[model samples]
Target chain A: MGLEIINTLILLLLVVAALVALRVKDLITASVVFGVYSFLMCLLWAEMGAVDVAFTEATVGAGISTVVLVATIFNLKRKSSD
Target chain B: MKNTSLIPVVLVGFLLFYASTDFPEWGDPQSPASSSPVSSHFIAKTGVDTEVPNMVTAVLADYRGFDTMLETVVVFIAGMAVLAILRNFSRKKPVKRGHEVSVEPDLIVTNTVRLVVPVIQIFSFYVLAHGHVSPGGGFQGGVLMGASFILIALSWDLERALTRFPINRCMVVAALGILLYAGIGVLSMALGGEFLDYAELEKVLPVSREMARYHAMLGVEIGVGFTVTAIMFALYANLSSRGRLEGGL
Candidate 1:
């Protein structure tokens, strides 16, 4: 029962993070929020017992993807279309 | 635009939540994925056939060795693709213009990286070699290993990191890793077994057939580790630098 509540909360946060990442005007902040979304998803997967997948998500999503996205944004003008 | 986007987002989220209700309960031992004969077969026989404690590693590096080999090559190819696209652009511009805009490496970041790098590298190898008993394997270990070099790149400057693991050397190591994997496959074939049949390794090795598969999986994981580490830095160096090989973000 406790696990169910935690899972729902995490899922909610994941949605919120994704929405904020989309809504944000700053590309860099959006990308960082995307990282947060990745992290939360990893946590959810870990909680579900897919430790291998969670590890990959933590490394790729939270670590490398953030770096790549940030670096890609650094080369662009900082403004968002919205 | 924001409101329009929000409608679809909320709709999608709602649908996803609704759909997730159909998924089996968490930790359901009888879930289709875990309850299938294929998984059960692996669980039952992986220990007897390979003598490796970790079923995932045995399945990945032994039963599905060919697939893993190709996956490693794919990583190497991604590094090369990034280099191909970004390298020339960086080279055309003067390198000095890069440093003018780049900040000097902060003392704290550099010091922390210096302290953490050795430990990270050690852990990467442990993850790679210990796949027979742990949750880690080639891909995970490789990513961790690559991240170590990337940490060097991140905390300091790209140049300092590159100096430690140069771009040319990175490519060579990446290619060699895949080669090592294929070489083992070909060796197994030559030893009167099918490709990637690690048990065939017992012909040349002193260990029993079961132990040969166990040790061979370790070698395969290490090869994966080498490729992943090299390409990881290579991708970071290229993408961050826009191929100029200096003053990477």
Candidate 2:
């Protein structure tokens, strides 16, 4: 029962983070929020007992991909035009 | 306009959530996936066949090795595609952005990174080698390893990081990783077994058949680690420098 509540909270945060990432005009902020979303996803995977998947998501999704996205954005405009 | 778009998006989102109600309860023993004969076979015999306590690792590096091998190749290809598109090999100067400020590497950040980089590298190695017993493997370990180099770049500059791991050597390491994976598979085949049949390696190694699979899985993981670590750094280096391999963020 406790686990269910924690899962629900994390899921809610995940949805909020996803919406913020998509809605934000600043690409850098979006990427960082996307990192938060990835970390939340990692947490979700861990809670589901898929530790391997969670570890992968933490490293690849949250860690490396954020840096990669930031690096790419540096070469372009930082703000969303639309 | 955005409000109109939101309606369909919300509808689809709800539809997807409603559809997900059909999925079996988490970890349900009676679920179709859990009750499948293939799952039972793996759960029952993975220990006996590979002598690996971590069934996920055994299944990934041994049973589905071909899929993982191709996945590594896919990573390599993706890195290459990015490089092909973004790498500016010409000697042209990078356009200066108005907001760019040339700043020296901070003492505190560099000092902290100096202290942390080795620990991260060591931990990555532990994750890679110990993945057989734990919840990590090549991809996670390799990403961690690559991030260490990236940390160096972030703390100092791309040149400093590139000095330690140059792009040319990065490519070599990435290719060698793929070669190592395929070589192991071919070696097992040459030993009178089907491709990727790690049990055949027992004739060469002193270990029993089960141990052979275990050790072979380790070798495969190492190959995966090598490719992932190199490509990760390479991707960052190229993307950050816009392929000029010069001054970068």
Q: What is the TM-score of chain A alone in each candidate?
A: 0.88, 0.88
- Candidate 1, B1-249: lDDT as tens digits: 747987987999999999999999866898999899999899899999999887877888898888989889899889988887777743355534433377778999889988988998888788777888978888878888888888888887899899999999999999889989999989999999999998999999999999999989988988998899899888888888777888758
- Compare the candidates by TM-score and give the number of the best one: 2
**Candidate 2: residue B243 lDDT (0-100):** 82
Interface RMSD of each: 5.2, 4.0
Clashes of each: 2, 0
Q: What digit string (tens of lDDT, one per residue) describes model 1 on residues A1-82?
A: 8888999999999999988998899889999999999999999988887777787787788558888888877666424321
- Where in model 2 is the C-alpha error above 4 Å? A78-82, B1-15, B93-100
Docking class of 2: medium
lDDT (Cα, tens digit) per residue for candidate 2, span B24-116: 988799999999998998899999999999989987998898999999999899788988997887776667655456679999999999999
